[model samples]
Target: MGVVEALVGATVFDGETRRHGVAVLVTDGRIAAVLPEHAVPAGAVVTDLGGGLLTAGFIDAQVNGGGGVMLNDGPTADAMAAIARAHRPYGTTALLPTLITDTPAATAAAIAAAIEAAPTRPGVIGLHLEGPHLAPARRGAHVAELMRPLTEADADQLVAATEAIGVLMVTVAVEQAPPRLIRRLADGGVVVSLGHTDATYDDVVRAVDAGARGATHLFNAMSPLGHRAPGMAGAALDAGSLWCGLIADGHHVHPATLGIAIRGKRGPGRCFLVTDAMSTVGTEGTTFLLNGRTARRENGRLTLDDGTLAGADIDMAASVRLLVERVGVDADEALRMASAWPADYLGIAEMRGRIRAGLQADLVHLSDRLEVKATWIAGERDEA
Candidate 1:
C-alpha cells in the first residue's frame, strides 16, 4: 500500500450531519487531509470511488456476540474472534464485547479475557459488563441469580485491567450499583452507563451527578418515561446532556420513541445506536448459545426458548438503515448514532469516531441504497 490513498469523488461525512464534496487523504492509517475534489494531493494514488457515500467506521458500543461465538463464553480468544468476525462484515468495524450478569469469577474471567483480546484485536475496543452490578427490578434478560452489589474489589480489578484497555464500560443502576464505586470507576477512566434499573428521577440525577457518562440500550432495559413518574428514563431524557445509546433495530425501540428521544435529547450530545445482539447475529439459523443455554432468533429478534427477549439480531450498520428507512431520519444524523456518538462516549473522540484529518482512517463505504460495499478498519480496506 502507498503511504497515502486519496479517495476522490467520494462524499465524505465527518460522522456528523454535514455532507460535502471532498477527497480523503489517508496516510499511515490516519486521515491526513479532507481535501476539496479539485485538490487531490499530487501522486497520491487517487482512488476514484465514483462518489460513493463514505462515513466513519461504525462503532457498536453494546455487542453481545456474533458468528456463533459468544464473548461471554469463558472470555477465550476463540470466543472473541467469533464476536469480531460476526459483526465485522455487517459494517461493524469496532465493538465492545458485552458480558451479561454472571458470577464474580465469571466476571473477572471476562474482564481478563477482554483485556487480553483487545490488544491483539484492535476492533475489539474494550469490554462492557452489563451486569452483576445492576438493578434486578429492571434486569430484562440478565440472569437474576447472578446479580449483586457493586463491590469495590470488583471495581478495582476492572480498573486495574483497564490500565491496558482503551476503554471499559459498565452498565449499572445508581440504586443498585454503589455510588462511590461508580464514581471511582469513572474517575479511573472507565465509562459508566446507567441501565437495568428502576431508579427514580433523583436517582438518575445522582448517577449523572456522580459522573456516569451514558445510558446503555435506552428504553429497553431502563424504566419508561411516564409523565406521572418520569423515572430513570425520564431523568435521563430530561437531563438532556448525557449521551444515550438506543438499539434502533425497530424491534427493541420503535421509530416514534426514537424520534421522541431525538427531539428530547437534541441539543449537543444525545443519542446513538447499539445492537445488543447476542451470539446468533450474522448467522443463517435461529438457534444460538447464551450462557450455555438454548437461545433462539425468530422474526429478526433473539429470545430464550421461553420467549424471553434476550437481545437483538441486528448489527449497527443495519441499525442505521432502520433509522433511515423506519424513522425517516436524515442519514447523517442517523449515522452519528453508530459512529461519532459512541466514539465520544468512550473518550476516544480524537481518534476513532469521525472522518477528519488525523483521525483514524476507519470508515465505511456504502451504495446509494445504503448497502455497505466496503469497510476500512485501521486502514486495511475490506470490500465485501
Candidate 2:
C-alpha cells in the first residue's frame, strides 16, 4: 500500500494572516494538516522548494478569456480549458468565466457550455453573465444593443434558467435592476455585484439593503464618486461590508485611488485585485478583438486602439506586485487581496482561499521577486 500524503517544504503563507516556514500536508486531494518547520512526515512525497513563498491559489470570480479563447466569442468547454490553462501558471486555481452582454441565444449557449464544462473542469466555478441587465449610460465596452434594463420577469427567468444550469453569478447596475432583484438573487444563492450603474447614494443604500453586497471593478464602468451627489461609487466606497474588486492594472483605477479603496474596505470585507483580463491575456504580440474593437497592449495595460478601457492585460500576479510595489501594501496583505478577500466575496472562502487545514490544496509559490514559481491544486503541482 502506498501513502497518499504530500509535503510542501519551507515556504508557506496562510492566505489571510502571515507567512511561515512550514510543511503543508496534503492527503486525498484536501489539505490534511500543516506542520511547522523541521517537522517531517514519514514516507510523504516531499517537494523541497527551499525559500519560495506559497499561499492559497487565487480564485477569480470574474474572467472572460485567456490564451486564445474568448469566452464571449462562443464560450465552450474547450474555451474554459483554454482559459484555465492560460491562467493556471499565472496562479489562478479556480475561476468563473464571465460572458459579457450578448444576445439571449448567445447567453443561453454560454450558460449551457459552462454547465457542460463545470463537471469536467473543476477549475471553472461557473458562468458570470455580466449584462443584458446594465444601465446603458455606463455600458463600458459592452455592446449597447444587448443591454437591457432588469425587469421582474427578466430577473425571474434569468434566475431560474441560470440556477438550473449551475451558473451562479450576475452583475447588474443597481439603477436598472428590478426593485427587489438583488434580495431575490441573494436569497436564491446567486452572488450579485453592482456595476455599470449611475445610482445615487440613496439608491445604493436601497440596493445594499436588498442584498447587493459587492461592487464590480470598484471605480470603473460606474458613476464616479464626487462630493455633491456621492454616486454609487461613493456608496460602494463607504459601504464597509461590500466587497470591492479593484483592477490594479493602473489604468482602471489609479494607484492612489487603489490605496483609498484598500484603506476603506480594509476591515471586514476589504478590497481585492482582479485581472478583468480579456482574450489576449495569454497570447503573445499584444492584440485582440473585444466586441469588434481591436484592443492593444500599451505601457503594461490593454485598451482599444483609440484608448477605450478594454480590459486588463496583466494577470493576478502583476496585480499583486502593483499592490506591494506601488500601493505600498505588505506582501501578506497583498496576498490576501488576491486570494482570501475575493474568495469570501463569492462565499467560497471556506474551500479555496486560506491556507488552513481542511481547505483545498490550491496554493501558489512565488519567488522573492513576486513572480510565480509554481502552483498546486489538490496536491498536484501544475506546469510552472
Candidate 3:
C-alpha cells in the first residue's frame, strides 16, 4: 500500500541475534517484514548493502552534549536539535538529551526545552535529569553547592512535568531521597534511577522496592562493592530487577571490570551501554564547561582540572567497538547493549530498538570494521 523498500545483502542483527542473507522491508517509515532475501515482494525497491552488518540504530539514554552544544549551555530546543544532529553521524538514531547537576531553575528550563523540542525533534525521546538531587561526596563533576535533597515540592514538580515530557528520568541518591519519593516518582511515570550515592546495599534495595529500576553510570559515581559491606554497586550487580547503564569508553571503567559486570548481571536486568558524551562528541572541540569548571578532553577522557572525570567523549559506535574489541563481548550482545537493551530500559523497545515488523525503521549499516556507512532514521537513509 505505502511506498515499500527492501534492504538486502547484509548480516542482519535483529536486536537479539544475527541472520544471514536476509532482507528487511520498510513501508511508511515502519518495518513491514524481515524475511529471506529471495522472499522480497514483487516491485519492491531494493538496496543491496554488499555484505556488511545491519542492525537497529543505537539508542543512548544518557547524552550530556554533542555537536558543540551542551544542555547546560542553552537548555533550549535549538541546543537539543544540535545535539541530536551531532550524534546522528555516529549511528545514534534516538537519545535522551541529558542535563547534569544544575540549579532548580536550570532544571525547569531543561524540562521546558525538552517538552518544546520533543514534538519537532525526532531523535530526542525525553530528558535525563542526572543530578541536583545527588550525594555531594560522590558528585564527580556536579557542583556540590547545587546538590540537595529532593523535597516534596520537587517530587510533585517532576511528576507533573512527566505529563508533558514523555520520559522523565531522574537520577537521585537513594540515601538522600527516601523510598516514598522514589515510589512517588515511579507512580508518576518517571523512570527513577540511582546514582551519585554513598548508599549501602540495604538503601539500594529499599530504593528498588520503591520502583527505582535503573542505575546511572554504574560503579563510577556510586559506592563501590565491598566484600564485607556490599554497597550500591553490589546491589546493582545482584539485583535482577535493575538495569545498569555502563560507560564503555574504556576510561570510566576497566575492560576487565566491564566484562565482569556484563557476565555477572542477571537477566530481566542487564548491563547496557550509554555514551555519557559531552560537547566534544561530534565536534573538534577539546574542552567544555561542567558546572562552570573547565572539563578538558585529552587522551580520550574528559576530566576537570583536578582530574575528576566528567562525562565521556565517546560516541555510541565507539562504545560498541570498545565493548567488542577490548572487553571481549560477543558482537551481537554488544550491539544489543547499545540498542535493544537501552530501548527496553527506556520502555521504547516495541517501537524503536529492533528491526522486526511493525517497529519504526530505525537502522544502521556498519562495515566489517564497525564504521558506520549509513543510517536510516525512521526509514530515511543518510549515507556517509
Task: For residues 310-361, write the lDDT of model 2, one tens digit per residue.
Answer: 7777789888999999988888888888899888888887788988888888
lDDT of each: 0.81, 0.80, 0.92
Candidate 1 Cα outliers beyond 4 Å, as residue runs: 17-21
lDDT of 1 by residue, 258-324 (tens): 9888778834657888899877777787787776678787788878777778888888778888889
- Can you give the TM-score per candidate against the true fold? 0.95, 0.95, 0.98
Count of clashes, each model? 2, 1, 0
Q: Model 3 residue 169 lDDT? A: 90
Model 3 agreement with the true structure over 112-172: per-residue lDDT tens digits: 9989987788788889999889999898888888899999999999999897888789999
Candidate 3 displacement at residue 153 in angstroms: 1.5
Worst 10 residues of 2 by lDDT: 1-10
RMSD of each: 1.7, 1.9, 1.0
- Report the candidate with higher TM-score, 1 versus 2: 1
Q: Which segments of candidate 3 are over 4 A away from where they belong? A: none
Q: TM-score-based ranking, best first?
A: 3, 1, 2
lDDT leaderboard ranking: 3, 1, 2
Which model scores highest in TM-score? 3
